[model samples]
Target chain A: MDRLIEAIAATQNPSVVGLDPTEALVPAQVVASFADEIADEVEDAADRPAAQLAVAYFEYNRAIIDAIADIVPAVKPQIAMYEALGPAGVDAYTMTCEYAQSHGLYVIGDIKRGDIGSTAAAYAGHLGGVAFGAGESGPYDPWHEDAVTVNPYLGTDGITPFVEAATAADKDIFALVRTSNPSSSEIQELELAGGCRVYEHVADLVERWGQGTVGQHRYSRVGAVVGATHPEEGRALRARMPHTFFLVPGYGAQGGTARDVAGMFDDAGSGAIVNSSRGIIGAWRKTGAYSETMSAESALDLVADAARNAAIAMRDDLRAVMP
Target chain B: MDRLIEAIAATQNPSVVGLDPTEALVPAQVVASFADEIADEVEDAADRPAAQLAVAYFEYNRAIIDAIADIVPAVKPQIAMYEALGPAGVDAYTMTCEYAQSHGLYVIGDIKRGDIGSTAAAYAGHLGGVAFGAGESGPYDPWHEDAVTVNPYLGTDGITPFVEAATAADKDIFALVRTSNPSSSEIQELELAGGCRVYEHVADLVERWGQGTVGQHRYSRVGAVVGATHPEEGRALRARMPHTFFLVPGYGAQGGTARDVAGMFDDAGSGAIVNSSRGIIGAWRKTGAYSETMSAESALDLVADAARNAAIAMRDDLRAVMP
Candidate 1:
């Protein structure tokens, strides 16, 4: 988180472009480019669709990484999109994260994984590089991301292994506190016995989990995912968890504007990194201005350029409020 | 859940063997069997360990599935174990699940995955055969399982997608209510304003989520993961969510005795399916009685036999109290 914060500070931008390259968002050209390759690898007609899409998603992610690597502080790839493509999809995910980090952007694999006992330890090992054998940090040693998202339903037991492992690796975890969804209020907003909401209770724990890992930026390695859609709650949680960083999702396509997320950051503009997935990567789809004379390869270059411009615009939008 | 219960009835046992094949629990013979094959695939030495272990875990799981297919109704392969091995690990998981189902055992992928909106729907599509497309049920159909575990922290939005998709696919879900870990009480057992525990609140919601999906067994497709370690709470949750089936974990090796899990079931002993992982699959490691006359191949066979017998012993033990 300190490294992440430092990156944000260095770029003077609290934006992490989300790399959720779904089939619909992936350009038609990108899918076509991989069609022959996927068909060659998989003979079955049925298997080719998932394989082709999987390749397209990875190629699209790599393009997006190339587009905004110099501008954004980080990239958050939601694991579900890649997991849907099966093993090959996961391999793409591994490659995408590797690509993003190599481009000097922090990678947050939004896995949202949690469990109990050794199972939790396994997730920690997978995401944070803490193994349990003679090959303590096994063959996937450097493959672990710098940070990952975790669900906190099973309480401290579900979260402690991640924290311990992250602390050991100098990595970080962002617990789902106030998520950016319509029905988030269904359970998260329910008032507790002490009159605080359930999310507030989780917020308290998020702060506690980072007690041992405060970094140079005055932010704990532990962080919270406060939705940009909820400004008042974000403001309240910001005050509550002073040392914790924030990974504020729900920006752009999710109906959250820069003004909506302004309250999530500290006065110095370093406590949070806002995310926008379709808003940036799929920006090419929104604009029907590509010239007919443009080649497929050149069109893809244009798409990456659009993403780069969109990221820059987002950075400026956020800077307007946060800076 | 009705189909799951019916399968259990056919076997006269409510036991689901957990196939969490961590390296420590996987036999040395199994690991060695894959060594040559893994070496053949990768000349690079650094890649050998994970690839070897990944194959070993899958082979171990295939053997276990074959061992106990007829005795047990279902097998829950915790995805984290395979995920720790990277993409190949996930491929092994997909294969293990497919193997279990092919052998006529219900496969409950204990991949505790959850997220907001389309991401959650992707998980449902991967774990169950429902998707967010024109096919909604497409060519990538046979890949899904009978049921999967879900984390309910993100509330209705995160779970609703799974519920909708599972209902469409005629599959089921088991939401984490009270985990068996020692620190589970830190949040799940927290008292709400109405004097109901957080798990109790989740129980009420689980019942509500399953309201439209009651099947022939008078159980909802949406189930609850009530830890066998929590007898009193399980008893309370049982009465509260009468329609909800329970997938009880933490039996045997986790200190959950037959008596401890008895309360999770109804009078007919059909409302819950108890799981035991290490206590069964790794049972051979507990006993060093294999003679020198037994070759490595025969030793692996013995290990499978031990798992089959252990599963049977667990079923008999549960029946003693349940019946």
Candidate 2:
């Protein structure tokens, strides 16, 4: 938690770019380059497209990471996007994590994994530690993140192992609280006994879970994923979880503006890090920054620059609204 | 849901072995055979143990699947154990799912994945469907599964995509309701304003989510993961969600006995399936079935028979109490 806060302080931007790549976003030239590389695999002709696209996805992530590593404090790679492509896609995710970290960016694995006790322990091991022998822990995984997002539906039993592992390794986790989706109100906004929403109850638990491990910044290793889209809930949760850092998703393309997310932070503007995926990576498509007269190759060459500028613009927008 | 129930009837067993392999469970002889296979990987000396164990873990899972494929209706491969090994581990997971289904066994991916809308759709695609260009759907992943376990923390938005995809593909989902872990009570058992537990609230949403897609057996494709350890809650939930199938975990090793899990089933003992991992795969260690006089190779050779017998014993135990 301290390391993440320090990174945000050093960068003067509590913003993390989300690396949720899709085939539609990958450059045509990059996909064509990897075509032959996937031809020799022992799969049917039908399976070759996803295999080739997986390699291209990694190359595309590398380009984005290299472009934005200096500006953003972190990069959150959503695991589902990579897992959709199969094992090779997982390989791409691993490589992307390694590349981003090598470029001095903290990585938050957006893998919302939750399970029962023993299985949760295994997941904790996958995130930060690996159990080699009884009562003996091996070294932490290099490919695993400094932090990871987790689902809290199975309750504290599902989350305890992760909390223990992160405390031991000085890593961290962000538990899903009030999410950014439209139908999230189906369960999250439900009225509890005293008019407290379900998300409030979850936030209370997250705050209590972090009480044992408060960091120097008055925050704890246990954080909350309070969607930036819900500014009212964000304000309430921020006050409720004074010591919990927030990983605020739902910015830009998800309809969360900088002003809407401002409430996620403390008065010092230091407690939350906002995430934007398509808004930055797909900025060229939305902004039409590249001229229509440019060839596809020329537009592809300028994408990295456009993404870098989009990230800078986001940082400025956030800074303007935050205290 | 109908397919699962029919398979259980055909096999006369509502139990599924969980392929949650860990390094300690893999016999030493199995690890030795795979040491050479991992020798060329670009890993440090510290990583070799896990890499070798990953291959051995796959070998161990294959043996277990082969042992019980004829007796059990299905097998649930918990993704965490395989994910602990990195990309290679995911490869082993994919192979295990494929192998189990090819042996005429239904495979349930115990991946408690949940996220916001767009990301959740990607996960749904990973489970059973994939979106290609406009109006086109790619080939379903054979390495995927007949069903998957999902965490419901992000509310209805996170779960809707999975339900839609599963219904369209004739697959199903098990939403985490009352999990088997001890600390699950921390949040799931919390009493809401109307005196319903948080998990009950989630169950209500899960039931409503599948309203448009009930199967032929008078049950919805959406299911609930009710822990066997909580018999009282299980009974209550069964009465409340009569049309929802149940996937009960926490048998044997988690201290959930056959009688305790009986409430999860219908009067005909047909609506639920139980999962046991270490209790089945590590039976040799518990029962002392492999003679101490045998060589490591001989003991490894006998593991499959031990596992087969253990699975049969579990099935019989459950049948004795179910009806």
Candidate 3:
């Protein structure tokens, strides 16, 4: 959490780009360009389409990372988009994480993974890289994530392992406290017998989960994911969980505005970092300059430029609301 | 759900083998045997250890699948075990699923994935294979799973996509209701203002989520994951979620007994299927026949024989308690 806060301070930006690439987000020409190469390289014809799209996703993510690495403090790669492509897509996801980290940007992996105690220990490997055997020099960290989002439905034991791993690796984890989705209310907003919502209880638990692991930045390694969609709730939660930093999502394309997320930050405007996935990464779609007739390189150039501009706009939007 | 029910009836065994292989579970010689082969195959020296273990896991799973295919109706491969090894491990997970399906056994992928609407749709591609492009012959079904487990924390929108995908693919899904872990009660057992527990509310949602997708077996495409550790709750839930099926975990190694899970079944003995992971897959360790000097082939043979014996013993144990 301290590292993320410092990176945000260095960039003077409280926004992070979401590198959630899909076939629609990547340029068609780029995917087409890889077809011949993929055909020759891949032995199975059935695996070609997914393999080609996976490569295109990596290229698209790289372009965006290169374009916004300096302006943004972090990049959140949604694992669902990659997992949709299967094992090959998973390869692209790891590659994207490695690329983002190499560019001096904090990589917040939006993998909301949760399970039982032992299994959660296994999933915590995203933070503590796999020590395959007795090992060589050290563990091979295939998924180079600085922080990852976790689901809190399974309770304390499920999250404790992640907290231990994050503490050990000097990384951070954001538990899903209040999500940005509409149906989130169905479960998260349910009233408990104690006159508090489920999400509120979860917020308290998240704060407790981060107790011993608070960094010098006055925040905990266990952050809370408070979506930008609920402004009033975000403001209320800001007062409730003092030690838990927030990873605010659902901005831009998801209809979350700067005013909505304004109170999510602290008095110093450092308690939360807003994220815009489709808003930033798919900015080229909104740009009228993108043409189907353009070559792969030109299309990618457009994607990079549009993403940079969009990321800057988001930063400024959040800054205007900041104290 | 109909497919699973019929398969369970075919073997007269309401038990599923859980293929969750960990470093401690696999025989030393089996992993050691893959060292030289992986060294020659994997270009990155750092990746050899994990890659080697990944191959050994697939081989180990293949042996277990072969031994138990005739006796067990299904195999639930916990994805977290493979994910611990990174992308190489994920490959093994898919390969394991494909092999089990080829053996005429239902493959229940124990991936408790849930997200927001759009992201859930992307994750639903686990059931609905990725349609990479227009010209693709058919979607490359990379994840060869007949059914998958989903987390219901995100509520309705997070679950709809999986239900739709499972319906379209003629597959099924089991949503986590009351998990098997000790700390699961922290959230699941919280008393609501409406005089019911949080898990009961989720149970109703699971029942409703599967409404329109009911099959010939009087069960819906959606199933509930009720742990074998809670018999009273399981029995009550069986009565509550009538149309919903059950995929019970924590049967053997997780301190659950056949007597504890007996009530989870319906009067006809068809509502629930119990799972045992370590008690079956890692059974070779308890067998005194296993020696460190044994060959990889001999170790796998031991693993297979021990697994078959344990699985058969488990089936008989469960049958003695069944209706």
lDDT of 1 by residue, A21-104 (tens): 877787677677777787789876666777777777877888878888888989999888887776667878888898898999
Docking class of 2: medium
lDDT value, residue A154 of candidate 3: 91
The models' CA-based lDDT, in order, is 0.84, 0.83, 0.93
lDDT of 1 at B62: 81
The 10-residue segment with the lowest total lDDT in model 1 chain A = A130-139
True-structure RMSD, every candidate: 2.2, 2.6, 1.2
Residues B1-323, candidate 1, lDDT per residue (tens digit)?
A: 77798899899989999999887777676687777788889775666777788888877888788899988999999988877777667878888888888899988989898899778987777654533222433536434478989988888888988888787777899999999999899788888998988888888988999998999999998999999899999998999998999999999998999999988889877799999999999988767766555665776787798998899899999999984
Models sorted by DockQ, best on top: 3, 1, 2
lDDT of 2 by residue, B201-244 (tens): 88898888779878788789899999989998999898888788
Off by over 4 Å in 1: A132-139, A290-295, B128-138, B290-295
Docking model 1 quality class? medium
The docking quality of candidate 3, as DockQ, is 0.73
Chain A only, candidate 1, TM-score: 0.95
Q: What is the C-alpha local distance difference test score of candidate 1?
A: 0.84
Q: Taking the candidates one at a time, how many backbone clashes does each contain?
A: 0, 1, 0
Per-residue error at B275 for model 3, in Å? 0.4
What does candidate 3's lDDT look like per residue over B1-323, in tens digits? 99999999999999999999999999999999998999999998878788999999999999999999999999999999998888999999999999999999999999999899999988998985555642445556789999999999899999999998898889999999999999999999999999999999999999999999999989999999999888899999999999999999998889999999999999998899999999999999999999999999999999999999999999999999999
**Sequence-dependent TM-score of model 2:** 0.95
Strongest candidate by lDDT: 3
